[model samples]
Target: MSVQAPRWRAMRVSDLPAASAVAARVHPGYPEDDAVMAERLRLCPEGCLALAGPGDLPFGYAVGHPWRSGSVPDLDTLVGALPVPAGAWCIHDVALLPEARGHGAAGEVVGLMLGEAARRGLPEAVLVAVGDAAGFWQRHGFRPVPIAAPAGYGAGATVMVRSLAP
Candidate 1:
């Protein structure tokens, strides 16, 4: 059977359940805590986007916000370690449902996020990637920063950055 390309758009309050469901399916082992996800859904509604197939069933999603150094310890520390420009975007998380893997959904999501960052006049974007996804982010122009440990992602995560047109 052939899978259809999912329709992607900015997420809304109504999309919370569907987005959460997709997130759960995508990151089963590291399921986002409900409270944190709820806050993200509430505060940065436009920062969240969803990819859905027929019937609007979510197949993937990407969530991010203006990288506020004060809000994240590791990110703040990482920022201190680098000589980045004044303003940069930070991507908190991006995930695709298992069924949607290998279909370039993640790239689409990243593209959208980067486009948004560009639209906001940000010059660069950063993210902490987990698992074997380091190579994936690399393909999107993200380069790893030499750090002892991933700041916001914890443990062995790798921190990556991509420059966007200012």
Candidate 2:
């Protein structure tokens, strides 16, 4: 028997609740604000994505917006809009439910997101990898940057970046 792969799509405004649930579950002890989630989708709908399986509810989500390279946004806080001169694609969060793990869905989403970044003429892709997820991002070619992470993202949180060049 084989497992069916989950599908990925642009995140809709209505998908926030499911995305929030997955975020709260996978990122234990990390904060997630409903309004912030909505604001992210509003700020850059192209960078917001959802992953789902045989069921209608989303099993995972990815949130991001175009941003500068040197600063990491605080967790659970809302940034009303992305900066006009946004140079890097800052991935805010990417979390999946346990049941959805091992399907390699994350890599698919990251690839799509990177393409979106390139399409928008962004040269760098940045993310704050919480916990040990840095290696996962590393597998996808992200390298750690020596920038400080925001408070409450917990220890081992790293700011990583990857080039979007082909």
Candidate 3:
């Protein structure tokens, strides 16, 4: 018998609790409120995804949305609305439990997010890489941008961007 590996899928509202748990586990140092995550999922469902384990519980999740370039939303704050003339895809957060790492699920979802951004006519994707995660984002074709990240993101936070243009 063979065991099926976990995979990324479109995030459903039902998965928010698991997603929040994943975030709490993976990013305890950079906490976000439950409402902040809910708002992101509500505002841009297409930008949210979950890596489901057996029984479909989320072991990891990604939350993103459209926003202006080179900007970092304040941590734990709810974004009232996405910008009307959104210029870039904002990768709000991606978290994975230790057990969920070491597979290609993260890369898969990053590609999905970037593809969706291109399809939406956005020119670039941006994110604040927290907790020394800049290298991971770099591997996925993101490059560090020389802009100061917000204080709430803590030290070593980097602003990264990847062009969605061909």
Candidate 4:
């Protein structure tokens, strides 16, 4: 059976469980830990978005948080190593279940998140991509920052950024 296109919208508190489940399916490591996800949701509820189809079951989710000074020191180190400005909203995580995979749901989710950032007057959005997903984010206009992964997040995770127009 074919999966229907997911409807993208701002995530609500009730969406947490489904969102977390999709995240587990997609991110499976590092940030997928329960505590981390809960903390992220608690910190920036508005930055989170969910994608659901006709029946309302979540297919994917994207969450981000304000990149306040020293918010995530490891991220700070990597961004600091770059020649670009050190401040940008961090996209904490984004994930889509296998059934939702090739339907452009990811782009819609990210677009909504970046749209929110732009509306807030932020100039850019950043993320740490794992696995083979770096290319996916790259396709969405995120360019890799020339810095190695910081402590605790592990290697091979590329940090990327995409400018959001003011």
Highest lDDT scorer:
3
- The Cα local distance difference test for each model comes to 0.69, 0.85, 0.89, 0.70
User: Against the correct fold, how does model 1 do in TM-score?
Assistant: 0.79
lDDT over C-alpha atoms for residue 28 of model 3? 89
Candidate 1 lDDT trough over 10 residues, lowest sum: 75-84
Question: Taking the tens digit of each residue's C-alpha lDDT, what string does model 2 give over 5-27?
Answer: 78888899889988988978887
> For model 3, how does the per-residue alpha-carbon lDDT over 1-166 read when each residue is reduced to its tens digit?
7767989898999999889888888988988888898898899999999998888889899988999987868788887999989999999888889998889888888988998899899999999998778899999999998999888898888999998888
Q: What TM-score does candidate 4 reach? A: 0.79
In model 1, the runs with Cα more than 4 Å from the true position are: 1-4, 69-86, 148-152
Q: Is candidate 1 or candidate 3 better by TM-score?
A: 3
Clash pairs, candidate 2, are: none
Q: Which is the leading candidate under TM-score? A: 3
- TM-score of every candidate relative to the true structure: 0.79, 0.93, 0.96, 0.79
> Residue 161: error of model 3 in Å?
0.7
lDDT of 1 by residue, 49-159 (tens): 878876777777787766643222243222323224426667877877777777778877888888878877777888777778899999999988874444445576887
Order of candidate numbers by lDDT, starting with the best: 3, 2, 4, 1
